[model samples]
Target: MEYQYPFSYDWTTQEIIDVIKFFEAVETVYEKGMNRDEFMTFYRRFKEIVPSKAEEKKYCNEFADSSGYSPYHVVKKMKESNPGDFVKMES
Candidate 1:
């Protein structure tokens, strides 16, 4: 939890905040549960900020390494679930 979220200096302040928010949602998925649509909104914004697959993977890997929470798994679960469902992951 003390780990810093991965971010690029090239991003604006708001972009950094949005990226942090997305990572927080990923944490929420592991810590408790998050609404599918809500988490998706954060993820959509994250994707907008990090459009490159390689870059996204890098950040995701960094976050996973630090927090032991896998954003990739959370996103995959959300994608595989039905609309209006709550997404939860094993911590």
Candidate 2:
């Protein structure tokens, strides 16, 4: 299956930090203003691990509620993993 936030290899640390900050800010805002039930929904949606079906459903549910407002969305810089040993990207 195609990754929703498909990893990119060229991203700098600064870029990733910037995204993290933004996500945190959104979490803070929603936590302050939204009700407990909605906030719980938001929190669950935020902590979703990569490549999980449960996470995918939370994403769809959040989209329906806000029409496209989520804080957990991050562009991960993922590399291939080897089951038995280290995997390296082509250089």
Give the winner by TM-score.
1
For 1-91, candidate 1 gives per-residue lDDT tens digits of: 5899999999999999999999999999988999999999999999999999999999999999999999999999999998899978977
Listed per candidate, the RMSD to the true structure in angstroms reads 0.6, 16.9
Q: For residues 10-88, write the lDDT of model 2, one tens digit per residue.
A: 4456544443443443444444432334333334443433246664555444542453334333111111222232212
Candidate 2 lDDT score relative to the true structure = 0.36
Q: Give the TM-score of candidate 2.
A: 0.29
> How many residue pairs clash in model 2?
0
Candidate 1 runs further than 4 Å off: none
